[model samples]
Target: MILPFILVLALFDFDNVLLWTHEISLVSHKIWFCDAIDIFYYLNTRLFLLFFYFYCLLPPSTQPQRKNSNSKMATLAKLLSSICVCVIVMLTTKAVEATPTYTATHCTNTTTYAPNSTFQTNLDILLYYFSNNISQSNGYFLGITGFNSVNAVGGLFLCRGDVATTVCNQCLTTAIKEIRQHCPNQTEALIWYDECLVHYTNRYFAVDKIDPRVNLNDGNIVSSVDLGRFNQSLHGLLNDLATEASGSSESKKFAAGEVVVTESMTVYGLMQCTNDLTNSECGTCLKNAIGTIPNGKQGARALLPSCNVRYQLYPFFTSSSPSSSGGMKLGPGTIAVVVVVPIFFLIILFLGCYYFKRRSKKKILLPSIMENFGDEFPTLESLQFNLATLEAATNQFSLANKIGSGGFGEVYKGVLLDSRQIAVKKLSKTSGQGTIEFKNEIVLIAKLQHRNLVTLYGFCSEEQEKMLVYEYVLNKSLDYFLFDPHKERVLSWRERYNIIGGIARGIHYLHDQSRLKVIHRDLKPSNILLDKNMNPKISDFGMAKMIDIDEHQGNTKRIAGTYGYMSSEYAMHGHYSEKSDVFSFGVIIIEIISAKRNALSLHSLDFDDLLSYAWKNWRDEKSLEILDSNIEKSYSYIEVIRCIQIGLLCVQQNPDDRPTMERIVSYLSNVSVELPLPQEPGGFMGNRTNQIPRDNISDQRNNSNTTGSSVNDITMNNSFPR
Candidate 1:
């Protein structure tokens, strides 16, 4: 074909028609004349080629030339039409792909209910309300109904961080209707759309949840060239977004950003959570979501009830106008290589060798010892402190600087270069915590933020040393005042009441408000610290366990908590949950009221424990006996009685009978709410009969002794108060 076209041009040039020179000036110079010549020239060439090729294939037959010409023309026309149709289809498909599509839907099978059941009705109503609120207001809303009824429904919804309010509302409204169709009459359902999420249940749904989660992988693996570098950039980008989003205000918890993955490619990411969740909750939720992102996937999304995380190669978040300030966005820029390639590799090699050497020495790997610790805290480098700085502040951890000790480490009061007073927890060399607990306290407490919770400033790990830095509480722990005869007398009724409410709010943060649902297994009076103002701050989370917000309870073989504070089921069978924390809180409340330890024997020989003694006195209509004699006689009798009633309800033998932290906070703040009658306390009279040898008991009070392995630790069942 090339040769023939060249020959035609050569023939035109030989005839002096190529340049339309003076010899061709005699011909009309109309534009249509040239066009006609160009068309005829190409058609004549093609016709000649076709005729020659067919002639070579066919026998020299006498009269079929005209018929063959018509057939060839028809074949050419059909091919051109097919090409046009394919182009049209391709354009249409690309248009559809540009729009968002529903990702997934998860409907729990265990929560199946009747079509018209009260629970289902409540769920529908609540979802509708959420939809309405989301449509009219911003892109996030939480709805909860039927507080005390059997058909209680609690839920929340969130839209993409960068989506427009109108689009978010439309997405949520569509999801609400679609969820019902997909999981008809289900008591609990969670549905996800590309733009928003719709979730509701018959029970209260807290922010941190992992189950029924949906993981969507784009399945496009990254290219091997620069794969490691790309992954490193992607992770750094997502982690920054997660932190920023979680730390955002309750009104808007969303972040979006992009990172230069390669010279020609950029990775985009977006993270968002329901505004109802706390900063820590949002962080934890996003961390969990990010953890579920499939390895090597170019694009992916992990959806949960409270949060959503996504990453892709192309920009998916809509650009917001300057007025909206809709979401956090990472500014575009090239990621500078801070470390040399060879040096980076050497660092990794050294770290790997160090880790292996520790393992060879029988030291537990931090990740191996704690389940889900990585998910709870994905990065700790930002919070790490220098051991040298801490030593200088604490005067080389001298005995003079020693303020307290606990099952995990020794506490030393330190003064920073800036004259900031801080408490340093130096992990004992032979302590059972090792790397796991040392990391746990740092990760967990650093994320939790509440006025009633001790603040974690930072942590240190250097030269075979691990220490946690905390804000020092000047007034010491609650036991300093509550148990001492002289100090106990100074704790007036007002102070005691304030202390109780503070403790309740702190525990409430742990159980419900914080990013993760945590059970502080050891909730004794000594574990509560007092500020300069005598306000209580919950401390010592070494024995704490983080669970899913929706989880009812958990079990462990090793029980590590105060005997009097441990619930009956937890003490004997290792069963625990938020309810276990409630039971412990109940014991603390009783101790606070009476100024007497729950496990210690009282003057009366009729009861073996304070729980039993408190129950007997309350049953006999002598609730005043449960109050501390140190309290002024002019105290509010109604408030004291109500507190006693609530404390008993919390100590119910059945964990289910115990009220939640939310309800406990309400009970403490609102006196008009009627308290339920107390049931027999857990392990009321069975302690004496089931008492184990006291020799195995190890006292953790006043921060004494370092914690050992969970299974090796002294069981609380064998440890009773003297």
Candidate 2:
């Protein structure tokens, strides 16, 4: 028994040393045990130890000495060893199978298919031509062979020296066959193999097409703490590889390099391009691919037009020769596993039992916390209000108290028992808004307090009733003066400009200055409420998102916003960013200066969008023509032109070109600063109007009323020029 235990311990000790070294290899290089086939090896060793233990347990003294008995035991041992060998073989096979394969196949020619007839015919002709070229050993180099035929359009080619010529031919043949089946009549297709690449396309995709690349790495990073440096090194190396690959000759468009991260860690990278591209084209394609990597991570793979590149801290490729540095040296911590495994197993079992014992007690304690939360937040406890008290407070939600009504709810002016005047927003149970939105509004708004943002007062909830209280804004919204004909006269260029500046400041606060960077996806004139002092306060955080400061953009399937103010990128692609809000601000600035809705304005002779119309007028030095007729006389032409230019700058088609809130604030405040020319605004009035329903306007109004209930009859009129 003692000998068996010692034998088992010795086997475990050997594996423990291997495990420790493997772990050190992983840690120092930021790889993993499973990543390097170490786990599989360790498991196989453990199984061998188990076999030895059973073998040693047999009673040798009582064993029969007959040849038949001895032969039987020998046969049994051989069978057991054979089983272990099989397991090891399967594990190794799996590791080999994990590597990606590429193949191409031939299609049978039929009278139905003709060259340049259909997209598929064109693609087939291209693939067949390339396959024949590779098979015939044509002297024509990759890019040099194809100026006249479809091959001139460009394709990918990968060659490995170790692979046999027959293997390469077979792989390409299989790839062509598979591509035809998978892509069917598609004009473009690509298939990968270990030895070769097969691709055919009708379109002129020879330009940098980096999309559709696969990224496969160990899902877990080796050291989360060193991620920043690792990512930086990875990006730097990738950029270099892209440059080298792109600059390679048409004969062999490939580049490989290794980056030393530390004394023990080295990251290897390989970049390869289709041998068809010119040096310049290859470089451009690879650069585009490199640009797509998400910042702040380890290990990435990208596909480029002429090349594909991958980088990892560990060596993924297998080599016939032993590495001079040794695969990866193991660390001491990994070696300790020999002694630590049994102890760890026992500790885990004990902890599991203790966890179950504690879990029972947690069940009893959870309800108490829930009850206390409900009692502390009275607003959440009730969903109904006394009809009589609401009626008495707002004179039965009388016409005098009525502020606004929309799809989901209504708003009315009310005075609470504490003598505080407030606006009451009552949401209908059957309204389009759901409970999640209602709760989201309450939670998000309660914690946000900005001078430019509306203040949420206490709320009242009773059976089937949801009401929100807000501080009353006596001056109404910017739309009151912005869209009215006669009322527009009250908004002098000064006040309109000030309002524009104030609104920008408010949005800037929500996006950057606040603790949470919020994107007000539904920013519009109506959402900009004004206090008695004519100071603008951005209302409605219900549709807002609290984003990480580092995040530049996000996507959502549900696109909610007023049509004209929404950016094209947001409307069409479901993508939104701070730049989306900037786009809206651009529209608002133009509306403030012109006192006209982008959707309703008919001043320009040729352009359909306010942004395009303004751009045309500015270029023609007739920008004053697009300004509000009422403000043109009172406002300085220079200031009006400047604001128009800034507005156009804010609504540029490219989000990257649009200034951040910080930049916008600086530009608006500094009159002498130079601004770049703006691109055509995307999602201009023409596209937006086509997609938004007429009822969406009414729905938005209702959403606001339901969200802001305390203000009574808030209307934009000539009487209120905030």
Candidate 3:
């Protein structure tokens, strides 16, 4: 009995002493040991002690004062022994119960390695290999029997002896799956199962070294009253554990101990390393781990080079007495020599490299192109153009030089000193427009470089002044002839067809082919300027959107566009798309064919709007009746019908039903293609009071003035002379 008691004490002392050593080493390293190894060590030692004590007290012959005692005393002793045995058995049973389980029959394995590799690529391969080799019939037996070693290098190993083999295998399998999933790219990784151990590495890992980088910190904050004392005690305890754990032998390099805080409370600690490490290496590892703790933290832990250390406010390990047969033995003066020197050098090297790399990469100045602009539209260098040079170019804003007038100002035709003819748009002094409009015109037009679009020459912005210069157009615009009666005779059918095609191509470029897909929200006849060759150039992209290809439509409440040409979706619902431009183009096409305005009037000799007139004519197969009188003699009947059909197709009620620019161009080029019937046009049933807004009135007037020579009567406007 005494021998067993002594053995139990020695075993307890061995673990306790190791734990003390680890605690001391942890304090030195400023690291905590709240890792898995520390938890396992603490639990294993307590359970062993409790089991040992109960086992020693079990035999009747071993009991003291057995023969001299009365029957009652003997009976009482027997009952006490039985109860102790039962308690120990129950504890062992519960410990096994606490461990997780795995069924070997469910284990699956697959080959994941390449033909040349020695190691398996994943956990499935390992399982497959074991399953095929170990069990041919009912799978491998489970419970404790499942954990025995099959091979020296790669075999099943159990950390908890009481765990069932089925449970151990299950735990190991789960751990293996988790590690593979989380760390798929890593060549080496490890995971701990409650009942078993699963680890794989590219190279063999030393089982004894507790890697110090993986320390765990308790998340709970320490209370102010006990913070200082708890920290001090924790530090002292962890350092001691680290020192003792590092000095442990090959069979076991683990320890558990406790330190009293108040009368009822004690802080328990545990420390450990893998058994493969040398005593010196273990000590060094623990010493490094101990130095990581700060002053006021509670429930801390550290994983060291050779061991791990942990301290907690409650006892988290199972308690059992140790067996009488064996206890670990250590030589005298072994602990002190194993710990001191190597730990001091590693700390110095780690901190130096961390701070040096952070200071080398940072920025200083802006790049060159942005610096030359002076962050404004008109720089000091650009304002150098003299007022005399401007006066000479514009002929002192003479009536002959004046081309047009707008809400903002009057436009004048000018010839620069270099003989470059330019259209100078000089702002009126009382103009409500501001510098923002000037900037917008400059920025928007300068970036647009399409062949069918007008080019911006330059701008003058000096001394509260603003002016925009553009390339001069010889023929005023399409509206000058298209909207006029007698002058419409000059525009042949061929010329009108050419103008329509040019406008479509220009709009196509704006909607898709340009660098930015733009929606020209305000396309009108006036906005289409005619060049010397009479080719139509679409202009005024100030209200255009640079849309992404993936986006379908956008909405805005701040509407800015001409009224008759605007799509119903855009006008009523605030939605705009590339198809909105298609709708506008349809209106333009009808206007070009009929040579008439879109406004509603009783004396117009047609329905309210061009869309309604066209739709009614097409349904009655009298589309050619709406053709302009000037082009009636020259236009082909088939071609006219084709144009009318296309116009109706473009004005479909549904935006999606409208043909894309590519499709429209194809339809126009191929006269034999069959066309689908048109649906009811948008805005077909609106109230008469809801006329296209006044903002759009200017666009109509401008169109009439520009195209007056080709459509309307050739009354020479005072703005620009032929």
**Winning candidate number (lDDT):** 1
lDDT values, one for every candidate: 0.69, 0.60, 0.56
Instruction: Compose the digit string of candidate 2's lDDT tens values, residues 508-605.
Output: 88888877778987777777887876788787655676679888789887666665677778766678899999988988888787776775321223
Regions of model 2 farther than 4 Å from truth: 1-392, 434-436, 485-489, 600-607, 684-722
- Root-mean-square deviation per candidate: 28.7, 28.7, 32.4
Candidates 1 and 2 compared: the better one by TM-score is 1
Single out the weakest 10-residue window by summed lDDT for candidate 1.
713-722
Question: Judged by lDDT against the true structure, how good is candidate 1?
Answer: 0.69
Q: Look at candidate 1 and give me any clashing residue pairs.
A: 281-515, 405-703, 406-703, 407-706, 407-707
Model 1 Cα lDDT, one tens digit per residue, 1-722 = 46434433443343432211112221132111223233333333333433344344333332355467656544434333333333334234322222335878888878677865556545645654565467566777776655566767777777777766656767877787788789887778888888878788877665566876988889779989878998899999999999899888657888888899777778889988888878998899898888888778888988888888898888666644332222223232311121233234335444645554565554444644234245644476677777766765666677766776545656787655444568887777767554556766777887789999988888876666778888888776666566655453357777888898999999999988988888888788777888878888887777788889788688887667665677777766678899889998888888888888665421233445788888999999998887887675758888788888888999998989999999999999998888888898875234554443333334333333322112112212110110
**Segments in model 1 whose C-alpha atoms lie over 4 Å from true places:** 1-378, 486-489, 601-606, 684-686, 689-722
Clashing residue pair totals per candidate (backbone < 3 A): 5, 40, 89
Residue 166 displacement (Å), model 2 = 99
Question: What is candidate 3's lDDT per residue for 675-710, written digit by digit as tens?
Answer: 787886764223453344544222222223432111
